[model samples]
Target: MSQTLDAAAVRSWCSLALDALGREREEIDAINVYPVADGDTGTNLYLTVESAAQAVEAVFAAHATGTTEPAPADAVRAMAHGALIGARGNSGTILAQLLRGMAQVLAPPAPGDGDHAARLAPALRRAAELARAAVAHPVEGTILTVASAAADAAEAAGADGRKAGGTRTDGTRTDVAATVRAAYAGARAALDATPDQLAVLGRAGVVDAGGRGLLAVLGALVRALTGEVPAVPPAGHRRPEEPAAPGPGSGPGAERDGGPAFEVIYLLEAGDAAVTRLRERLDALGDSLVVVGGDGLWNVHVHVDDAGAAVEAGVEAGRPYRIRITHFGATAEHPPEQVQRAVVAVVPGEGLAGLCAEAGATTVLARPGEPPASGELVEAIRRAHAREVVLLPNDAALRHTAAAAAEQARTEGVRVALIPTRAAVQGIAALAVHQPDRRFDEDVVAMTTAAGATRYAELAVAERQSWTMAGICQAGDVLGLIEGDVAVIGADLAATAEAVLTRMLAAGGELVTLVLGEDVPDGDALADRLERYVREGHLAVDTVVYRGGRQSVPLLVGVE
Candidate 1:
């Protein structure tokens, strides 16, 4: 039996929770009769867990090439952060808060935390308290009640352990496993009692949908600790003889009791004071208000009549992006519409950015000497709002980072394919033939083929004296690098570019594209002369030029 909650155990818990939610999503959706009976509690829960699982996977990927394992704190923090950014609905938002609360205590696992079990009781308690505080209107007979009972049971179990000589030599609790087991048992009992605590649940002949989701999560935690999966619990009505009246929140569009018309959510970059004010403003605007995350970044969610006003509030307080608005009433019976495909490319220059944008691809600008993190790529995918996505890293060094981002996006139900485009020109070539209407696999293959067929070269001034493949080059020497290796060294810009172009075409080519940087000397004249040379020396070879405006490199050449 497993006894400690290490990094691996945390990962296991997230994976198990996702699997459990997947198995029970439809059942939970059928019984969502409280706050709003939109029939998506199970799906939201699954999505929230998926995000958490992705975060854990990212943490592990970061350490994949290393000898040491990641600390439990690192894993826990990623899980919480993932949930905050990807939370879907009311229940999902509260679950994010609960994970955040647990992370607060478990992230820095105290000095004397010998066994992982000792930390479970306190984390569960903190999670319960924070989850309660996050909700605008606290209601019992729901997930809140179930979470609270679990905490209470954990504390009671701790007390029982103390009475049974559970104290360590330093007078600390010794039996953390017992406390966790008790908490899981208490949560299950609370879930069964949910029908009695709420009139809506009783009328609908179902348990609280949110409570059932929490029970599944807690049971996953138990399995992760002890290596024994629990039997799936029943949802909704226990007996066929029980009443099955339609939920009170049911109307023509399930907009019963005149609640908000839309659900608005976004990620905001703001200060703590601004967030406090935002909370107050949002609470007044609508019900089911949830603001989660910290340290300059936050995830805001609320149900409101005016979705525009809700997004405007975020803009007034701070910068908000990835704004998603859903009509709660209109889609009561129908699922959401899916976008076919999108491409997210990381480009080095503004010119390339515009080009990619015009080709129906989302572009991320790469600042000089500053690379983007995996989170930024994930955010870009979120902004695309498509079911299928193609990602272009545009740099060889970013292969690992791009892979991690694609993995994270996949967890959130996005189909992401990472194309290894080692240069911006290759990405440009790939985007030239993007077909959103085509099959996913066929489109990906076509893009990949375009990117692979292009042979790329760059012109840059040597930073310092160094020996290269061609010869020894001094600082200020114009260096021509082909396929990441220096192939030609010359004293003049025109001479070096001519030699590089000659060598590239020697391998044979039908088309050549030249990108001139901000500092390129005589840019227009150089491009004209190159085009003339290609036409004269290699018949039927076409040439094109664009103002690259990128730093460090003075010119880029791609031959296909």
Candidate 2:
């Protein structure tokens, strides 16, 4: 009986879903059993959804058209598209793909059918398929599995309804309320079984976080349809603060020689002519102009300094919509002290933070949590007052943020270098050889070389079933990675650790340093076994440092 969804319902569902994800973000991250402890799945999924929600809200406000039914297909499409470009980690990417597929199915036709429920059934099915395709290899007991089950259930509901003469031909049939309810039940059931299906979840005593996030979104959608808000618990994660207000010199007419401090964002609703003119005007103002979200609503995000001017320009173009202006300052800035240099690292866990700090890094930004903003990073470096700054973005997810920080710092006349270190182990290795007194260029070259020479080894669980370079990884298999590549897969952590160690030392290393991670089993026992290998003349020990805390991975630094 549902005809079309209004903007408010779409916004409400998205907000409810995000609230659910915010409550359980950390628990999902902890289920990462890969030798490396980059638990960012929960965080990534939440951010992806949050971006979509924001886009939906912007679109609704710009259009200002009222409807009490289900959300229009175009609205869903805009939200999906926004999430696609803003997606961060692997989980986020997969979720974005799912949204993209769903959007395609829900795309309006030439005639623009008003049957929202009918369109959604097909969209949900396509979403599942797209999500499965996004992964190199699909795995059960994961998000893919949950989505697939939900899609199948929805399809089944459609089929049952069709048999009862409720559906129509051309795939534009209506009356999907029963199907949606059935799909939700199926998805919830699948989510509950994730712990038993995946060993990491079993160990962590939780369901698959990504799967849970998808379930939350689905639950919200069902609630919107049924007019009943499900009692979904909040997912545990950091709440993103509302965008800050424009500063004293930050309004529309503000002028600066370099540019404004933050990027100004606003949504515009007008005809095509207005949009074209606005685009040309904003092009002259700043860079990174992403003007998306169509269907009488234009979601505008631009990097500009003159917030007031930008707002004026937008207002002049068309009706002013939901306005959110964030000030993203320049990336690079000069430091005061010529003797000291700062290195900013993006690593997870306290143990890695300690290691980076010991290695002359002034600041260590934790991952799988709220990463420091570019402005914050620049401020941190400026506070350190170092002459030259080096950024070690240990997590690949933080690379863009680090680059942005570096860019802002450079703009502020700070000497900053961003070393593309992908893992915490690499960051630690790079730091070991960093010479603070050396020339900046020389130090960068030396650190890059050291990072390349280092190898990583750790014991963890496989998050999904995929064919890695090492072998076929199952849901519960304990995995070990060497030099950023999967090295071993087995149930026994000690055995896998031994295999990784042997491979790392097979290159005839002179000295081996093993830094045991927090969740590593029996550090002393593992070290003792390694000692026997050293005594056998296989490798020499160079003082093994054991730190009991979370880190990227157990590292094996080969000292020549």
Weakest ten-residue segment in model 2 by summed lDDT: 328-337
Q: Over the stretch 430-455, how does candidate 1's per-residue lDDT look in tens digits?
A: 99878889999999999999999999
Q: What clash count does candidate 1 reach?
A: 0
lDDT tens digits, residue span 218-321, model 2: 88787766665555533322223312343354322232225445555554677767877887777787654545434565555555667777788888888653
Candidate 1 residue pairs in backbone clash? none
With candidate 2 superimposed using the best TM-score fit, by how many Å does residue 81's alpha carbon deviate from the native?
1.3
In terms of lDDT, the best-performing candidate is: 1
Residue 17 lDDT in model 2? 71
In angstroms, give how far residue 306 of model 2 lies from its true place. 39
- RMSD of each candidate relative to the true structure: 7.3, 22.0
